[model samples]
Target: MIHSVLEFLTDELNTFIKLKVGDPTTTRIYLSGVTNEAGIAIPDQSLGISLINIEEERVNKDQQNRFVNAVGKVEKRNPEIRLNLYVLITANFQNKNPNNSSDDYVEGLKQLSYAISFFQSKNVFTPENSPGLGSFDPNLQKIVVELYSYSFEQLYNFWSVVGAKYLPSVLYKIKTISIQENAVLEQGEPIEQIFTQSQHKS
Candidate 1:
């Protein structure tokens, strides 16, 4: 499920870049990790989408999430596993020198700005919103993209943990990725009003 969502997003972003720069093959989006076939971080210019964190939607635990079966029977299941995906999109520019005339690294910042605008313009995505996906993932119903702000300390800590120098990057919180399995836990009877004693001692 995660793979499908990410793949869809990657394709959409690639399309966006192609349209913006008027060159379909200019840039590429990676699934994070600056690795090659041999698994090594190489300096390259492209967009990297990495999943930084995952959190279950505990607030929806009480809601009964379910799906209709083929036999026309509504099957009640446990609450759907709603997840918030903290995705980091990093622009890896080859040249890091700011003073150089031909610095792709600074170019990375420009690319990052482009991405920010793209998301700002289209913050919400659904199967209907994105027609280019063709046969969109069935499990993916909808997704909301939101910009995540971080403190200076948090930003420094992230790079430190990644064990790499800072790259022009932005973080987005992709919210409410729901995955529901049609597995019924238990059937429950309907609830009725309960009898209670009066506090005034009637």
Candidate 2:
């Protein structure tokens, strides 16, 4: 079930972002810092599945059902590939405080900082558990932390692209893109900077 959910989220994200499956360039999910004995880090992908474990949160029921349906579709279409999913957790404060008010905006930043710190403290990415690739550099990790910290708008854009009926495209994109530390940030600056630099580039 978890695998299906991860696959579904990957597909949806890719479709919205216009990336291809197994592209090794543009697709990836952000799992949260939760880990198991195998040290597998569960990010957004895992959280998405975890939500299904809840029986009470009906407000998000539609979203959850979409994800489940996505899993079945992905399995029928692409049975051979095992998609990667990332898990990312927002701090309790970020989840509770709506990001509309000025005070919430400031608090959101602080909460983001705390979330990053919590992930780092757990040594989320180390050489021993590099998904059997290689250990991620500490410098790279810091950059990833910074990018996710400063790029909420990009996150919004990415997810916004993942609306209804685009699940297959989204899965293809995730499989294709490489989930490196600075992939998103390296591709585009913080949302504010991108807007600022657009004037210069133009």
Q: Residue-wise lDDT of candidate 1 within 1-202, one digit each (tens)?
A: 7777778887788778778767787656677664445532533667788888898878746585554666655557877688889888888776656566435766678767778888899988876887644465766768788999998999999887777767778999988888876588544543447888867755
Task: Please give, for residues 8-99, the per-residue lDDT of candidate 2 as tens digits.
Answer: 33343333333322344542333333333443333321121112111222232222111123223311111122222333333222223354
Query: Which candidate has the top score in TM-score?
Result: 1
Runs of candidate 1 exceeding 4 Å displacement: 34-43, 65-76, 96-103, 186-202
Estimate the lDDT of model 1.
0.74
For candidate 1, which ten residues in a row score worst on lDDT? 34-43
CA lDDT, every model vs. true structure: 0.74, 0.29
